[model samples]
Target: MSTPAPPFSGFPAGALSFYAELEEHNSRDWWLAHKDAYERDVHEPMLALLDGLEDEFGEARMFRPNRDVRFSADKSPYKTHQGALVGSGTVLGYYVQVSADGLRAGGGFRAASSAQTARFRAAVDAPASGLALEQVLQSLRRGRFEVLGERVKTAPRGYAADHPRIETLRHKELMVVRDFGAPDWLSTRRALTKVRDTWRSVRPLVEWLSQHVDSDAATT
Candidate 1:
């Protein structure tokens, strides 16, 4: 039996200004200066939420906030957002990305150090992985998906070209599993309930895909 999701009541506070502050300063120096507030007000609460989730799901993990930005030219010292997971092992926990808009849920199950983002992109494009991809797309199609950031112009798969969520999809790497439609204001209890409900709905499809993939692998 899957564990019940944590209560939504435990969600972090002051997330909007935290994101705004990061964007406004947009530099390592500024983050360093404001590090205490960021950790106390933003990181700690997020970690607590993750801890609650981990207690329920048995495998969610939070990545350390110290980002490795040495290879990139952008040089932003801190992540503009935060995240956590609810599953275990190589298959990452159901992932969540928190920004000024709210909390969004999706998968972030990648293993490679160098090509993690690329693999996610490929997964979205892969016909075999389309089941997971389609679940999300269908939600967006039904207008159930919410855009957390500023609205944009492009539509998702089912919507017309001018659909608002399109812009959010365009800004982020759409293939990455960070597009789940959770709202930040949702209480942790409610969020957990929704997660369980969603997982129940999708589990059969996920299992079918797993079996199919295994059979194909054996044949190959």
Candidate 2:
């Protein structure tokens, strides 16, 4: 009979080492050789982490390790890192990733449609909602989370260049992230604590995006 996996204690150091080597040797042959280590050291630990978070954070889905190369020039067969998402049905959610660099955790929105973008920019242009988002970002920044997003060089089509929240309106994607490079805590249960705390810290932004951008999608 096969042995069952142990509960998540934390990701092993081997997880980090495995990814580090994968980065240097990103090829089909190398990955095939290391697949066993990947399963034992990386995949199972992440599952345990997600299981640990589900009670509070909702269930999370890990991204497939295989890369879709049909539309891309870089046709490497696999992803360099593994990532997962919680509360992701809408445009907003919490995200986490682990790799050679260590752990990264945060929350916010991505893959917004034109309609969602319209709602997002309209909310940013308004007084109450605009101020609320700004405040959430400020609060997260104060707590050491880095607010990040893709942006246009100029304001989107109807908003003025000098509009008060032009910068925010330019965002196509927005999120807050923290990188915890291979720390001593990574190989212990404490890694869960750090990820949980970071996700909680950024939850406001994700909530704000859901309220302003995602909430209306059901109707329109």
TM-score of each: 0.55, 0.92
Residue 99 in model 2: shift from native, Å? 0.9
User: What lDDT is obtained when candidate 2 is compared to the true structure?
Assistant: 0.85
Tell me, what's the RMSD of every candidate? 9.3, 3.3
* Best candidate according to TM-score: 2
Q: How accurate is candidate 1 locally (lDDT)?
A: 0.49
Question: Tens digits of per-residue lDDT for model 1 on 3-67?
Answer: 76433453455665677777777777777788787776566666656665555455555655556
Q: Which ten contiguous residues of candidate 1 have the minimum total lDDT?
A: 211-220
For candidate 2, write residues 1-220 as lDDT tens digits. Answer: 9976567798889999998998888899999999999999999999999988989989887888998888899988888888888875644688889999999999887745678778888889999999999998888888888878888888799989999888888987788899899989899999999999998888888888878776332110
User: Which stretches of model 2 miss by more than 4 angstroms?
Assistant: 1-5, 215-220
| Candidate 2 vs. true structure, TM-score | 0.92
Model 1 C-alpha RMSD vs. true structure (Å) is 9.3
Instruction: Return the number of clashes found in candidate 2.
Output: 0
